[model samples]
Target: MSRIGKRPVDLPSGVEAKVSGQTVEVKGPKGTRSFTATDDVTLTVDDGKVSVTPRGSSKRAKQQWGMSRTQIANLVTGVSAGFKKELEINGVGYRAQMQGNTLKLNLGYSHEVNFDVPQGVTVTCPKQTEIVVEGADQQLVGQVAANIREWRKPEPYKGKGIKYKDEYIFRKEGKKK
Candidate 1:
């Protein structure tokens, strides 16, 4: 038995959850998110809560059972409270700006990088160096932040590049003369 799978997911007020066959959909004040469970896992929603049960006690079944439950729970919480990712630019010439529904970044490259903001997701910059990404789906918000960070990952030698807020990058000393 999986401990996480055995736990029931509590639906917050104003959030609705529906399970149909292999797919589960959760709608909240922020937005709606849906996910399909694995074939070995079954999902049921009732009485303001959700549950996940495995078809058998096999190892894979146990793993899937826990994973499916966690995923569903994340979906519910994401739609209710939403998700956010913060990034900081740590170089002299590095900066970012929002143009229309796109983000324009200058990461010491010859040409600027432009990324389109997907629907249901919002990006904001309180300061030039700080960027925040918000969305109702945890997976999507995280993936978008990762893609932006990949454009200019922090370097070890100078520790200058884009990185998540509160992230630490080890710095290397310059070569001896």
Candidate 2:
């Protein structure tokens, strides 16, 4: 039995969920999101709750059972409360700023890196060293934050670069002279 799949996802007061075939769609104040589960799982919405169950006892079915349940839960949360990711720039001259729909990043390079914000996700610079990514879709928000951090990953030597706010860098000792 799958622990995550055993629990039904409850729809908040303002959130609504619908099921069609293997697909589940959720709508709330933030936005609307949908997910399609594999044939290994069955999805159903009942009385402001979503449930997932495996179609068989195979290993693949059990795997899909948990994953499908989680995906459906994410859809509900995405539409209701949304998702957010934060990035921190940790270098002397490294900074980020929002220019219209573009994010301008100065990561010690000769030229500035211009990252075009996607349609669904929103990127904001609360401070020069801070970047916040927000969107209704959890995957999109995380992807956008990762793309920004990829420009300059934190180094073990000086720990300088873009990184998640909760991330910790493992520092390496310097070579002896």
Best by TM-score: 2
* Backbone clashes in model 1: 0
Compute the lDDT of residue 143 as modeled in candidate 1: 92
Q: lDDT for every model?
A: 0.92, 0.93
> Which TM-score value belongs to model 1?
0.94
lDDT of 1 by residue, 118-177 (tens): 887899988889899999988789999999999999999988999999899988898999
The alpha-carbon deviation from the true structure for residue 123 of candidate 2, after best TM-score superposition, in angstroms, is 0.5
What is the lDDT for 96 in model 2?
96
Screening candidate 2 with a backbone cut-off below 3 angstroms (N, C-alpha, C), the clashing residue pairs are: none
TM values, all candidates: 0.94, 0.96
| Reference-based lDDT, residue 149, model 1 | 96
* Candidate 2, residue 68: lDDT: 91
Cα RMSD to native, each candidate? 1.3, 1.1
Model 1 spans with C-alpha error above 4 angstroms? none
